[model samples]
Target: MRKSFQKIAKKYALLKQGWSPQQNLFYGFLTYIIIGCILLCLPVSQKISAPILDHLFIATSAVSTTGLVTISIFDTYNGFGQFIIMILIQLGGIGYLTFTTFMLLSTTRKMTLWHKKILSTEFTLPNTIKIKDFLKSVILFTLIMEAIGSILFFIAFKNEGMPTLEAVWSSIFHSVSTFCTAGFSLFNNSFMDYVDNNFINFIISMLAICGSLGFIVITDFGLMIKNKSHELSFTSKIVIYGFLILLTFGTAFFYFLEPSIVNLNDSRFLASFFQCMSAMTTVGFNSVNFGVFSQAMMLVCIFLMYIGASPSGTAGGIKITTLTAVFAIMKSRLRGRSNITFLGRRIPYERLYIATSSFIFYSSIIAIGTFLITLTHNFKFEDILFEVASALGTVGISTGITGDLTTFGKLVIIILMFIGRLGVLTFGLAIWSKTITENERKVLKEDIAV
Candidate 1:
């Protein structure tokens, strides 16, 4: 028996060498999903006894950091099941190996080369050379941010009359969810009751915003505060300026265009502000019924979700930096400039290609996904498009029609959520082990009108 086991282990090790970073991520994600599904199907969750599709849907939802669900989180799953889901959310949000490396570093004070390589790929870091410090920072920053968010949420909940223990639990869960931008909520309506509650809304929104901003930005901000001389990266500057502009414009647009929202005399501003933040960050926690939102508001939400938050964050969509890069490229070209510049710094061509590729790939996936989902469901074109965008953005906001989707439709969404969370390029790269070599021979060039 020992000899046979050794033989099998050796065979597996041989196959592992051919695995690319993308393949590793793909397999690791699948392992998490399978484990999540098994745990969710246990007797504790039997009362919810969702169809297999629902289990896959929720498992995919949790692991992909996409919050779309076919059932009420509070009512459908038992405490045990809810706890399991929360664990998955935490793991999926920050990533599978990020926490593991943190644990190793804390326990042993060193990261093996193999560990660093995995962490680099998982976080999309440019290199794995000095990932120990990065891992440590990620862990420490996550704890501090989540702690602050929890305390503020707890205070807000206490003000709303929740009992001490319940308030604490709610705060902790929400803090993790918000800071990870993973929109899992214990409440059925997802903070709808707290729409006018300034303390809660602001705390949650701030957490979501901070989380959606990449860790690199957080690190740079920390350096700026601590050293007082370190320069912020151009990418950071673009992200900050762009984020502020979008938030301001999106809030005003939603407030003015949606009469149903504006008609809410008491909480009009709060409602509009929260929804704007929610959609732009791709956090997906809704304070109002999306079903009643005007066509204009729906379009606005779709646009926000598509642009999404920053790169290297839990949030999905095309990402803010990518959009900013594309605009910068266009402006430079229109000006007949030799280089793309932002904040007085030239952006690298490699980064520009990545941004352009990401945008095109994201748009293509959404278009294809929308068409596929339409064939499986009887919903209106707008609603179907909204649902597909929500999935691809990892945004959970829905048209109150998710539960009515066919089994096939739900599966399609599950795949979209997985692809969205991992990213389109990463997914493609992970499945293909070898890079395609381009032919060097060039055909005669033809000039085309711009």
Candidate 2:
């Protein structure tokens, strides 16, 4: 057994050497999800007997940090299974590569050339920050933030008369879940029961915001504070400002458009703010029932979900940086500028290409997913569209249709969730490996009609 294990490991290591960093991440996530599914299929892992596919669905959803599930997590999984899921969420959210890097760094601060190359591509880290410092910051920041969030949640649950053990467990589980933007809840209705729960809502929203703001932005913010820098990095500025702008826009729009849906008895501001932040951050928690929302507001939620979260973070999306770049490029083109400049800095052509390409890839996947799902299920266009968007965004806010999906539909959602967790671009590269040598060797250029 040991020989076989060692042999497999050796082959895997050899094969991985030829893979791009993106492919490494792709397989890493896939391998993790498969292992999670196998564990979740164990007799002890589940409270009751369920089909193997259901277990796979739960495992995939947990590993993807996506809350889309056919089973009620609260009822389907035993404490052991729930704990496993929680661990998977945390690992998935922080990324498996990150843990690998930390392990490598613990014994030796120095990273090899190959290690640095993979880390650079995986996290999109700036050259200015050492790999060791970046890994440390990612770990320390996640722990510290999750710890603070847990304390607050524990107090809130204790106040609600939940037992000490359960409260503590719930607090820790939810703090990590919320901060990681996993949104897997022990509650049946997600956060709907806590619509008016001030303490829980506030803490959760804050955690989701911090988590989805992207780790790069968080690290940069820390640097700014430590050095008292006069300004943020261009990427950080775009993320922070764009996030706030989106938050405000979502809140105000939801407040006005869905005034009829808001529970007036509770704090309307809290309801509005919480759902807005939740959707924007791709955190599936919702203080209000989205199904009850007006069509206009539901569409608004879809749009917010589509925009999703920032880059290099727990949350998934086309990313704020990409969208910011796209908008900047449009502005530049309209003004007849020769070069794309943002915040007094010139944007490289490669950067603009990535932004545009990512945008295209996101749209393509969403469209393809929606089309494929419609073939298997007879659902409203809006519901089908919403499901696709939710899966592709890695945002688990469903139109209450996820539970009724057929086997084919479930399979579709699973694929979307997997690709969504790994960016569309990364998926493309993994399936269709590209070579710089080939591109440079071919000098052919063609223009497509605009």
Candidate 3:
């Protein structure tokens, strides 16, 4: 029996070694989703299951951190099922690679080169050659942020008349979810009831902001504070500045243009601020019905979702850094300059290419997903577009019609969520590997009339 077990293990190990890094990461994510789906399909979850498609939808939503749901979370799933969903959200947000690395760290007490490579890709780090420290930092930072967030939320809930145990659990779940930008909510209508509740909105907004800022920026900030001479990384600086600027503009635009929001009798400032933060961070918790939003406000929300939080963060969308790079590149070209500069630093051509490619890939995926869903569902173009953006951005705001989507529409959304979370470009590249020829022949230049 021992010899057979060893033989099987060796065979699996050999097979795994032959797989590429991208393949391994893709398989790992798929395996996690399959396990989550199976668990969710159990009798415990079936009690709340409206349909098999609904269960799969919720499972995919949680695992992809997309937050799109066919039913109210509070009414649909039991405590056991909700717990499972929360676990999936945490795992999905931190990433399968991060989870595997954590497991290896616990069991073998060491990280191998393979682990570092996976971590690097997951975090979008410069190199995985020396990633043990970064991995530790990522774990520690997440725990600390979630812990503090939970405490704040618990205090707020407790004051609102929630019992001790329930309040604690709610706080813990929401803190983790918000910080991961997973957008799972215990409430049926998200934070709709708390639109004017400054305290709750502020707490959630802060958590969302922290989560979407990315671990790289957090680490850089920490190092800068510790050593006065050590400046923050250029990438971190750009992300911070860009995030603040966008948030400011988004908040102001919504406050002035949206009558539904601006007409609120009390705490209108808080409502506007929270919504702006939510949209910018791709943390889809809404304090009000998004369907009631004016066309101008809806467009603003779409734009904010399109230019989402930083890379290596829990949030999705085209990513703020990418948008910033595109603008910089365009400005430089318009000015007849060869170099794209931001913050007194020249952006590398390679990085610009990456940013451009990411934008193109992200836009293409959203367009395709939107087209497919429209074919199956008899919904308005605006509604379908909203849903597609929500899935692609991993933003949960909806027009209150997600639950009515057909099976085909649901599947289309599930695919969009998965691709968005994994990153459209990364997933595409993983499936289609590119090769360079060793021998290159120079091509003659041909002139054409302009």
The lDDT leader among the candidates is 2
The lDDT of model 3 is 0.82
Local lDDT at 186 for model 1: 90
Q: How much lDDT does each candidate structure score?
A: 0.83, 0.84, 0.82
TM-score of 3: 0.93
Off by more than 4 A, model 2? 1-4, 229-231, 263-265, 436-440
List candidate 3 stretches off by more than 4 Å: 1-9, 103-109, 126-130, 434-450
Which residue pairs collide in model 1, if any? 22-430
lDDT-better candidate, 2 vs 3: 2
Which is the better candidate, 1 or 2, if ranked by lDDT?
Answer: 2
Over the stretch 223-256, how does candidate 3's per-residue lDDT look in tens digits? 6676788677777878899999999988888788
TM-score of each model, paired residue for residue:
0.92, 0.96, 0.93
User: Cα lDDT of model 2 overall?
Assistant: 0.84
Query: Between 1 and 3, whose TM-score is larger?
Result: 3
Q: Judge candidate 1 against the unseen true structure and give its global Cα lDDT, from 0 to 1.
A: 0.83
Error of 3 at 222 (Å): 2.2
Residue 213 in candidate 1, Cα distance off native in Å: 1.1
Q: Candidate 2: deviation at residue 112, Å?
A: 2.9
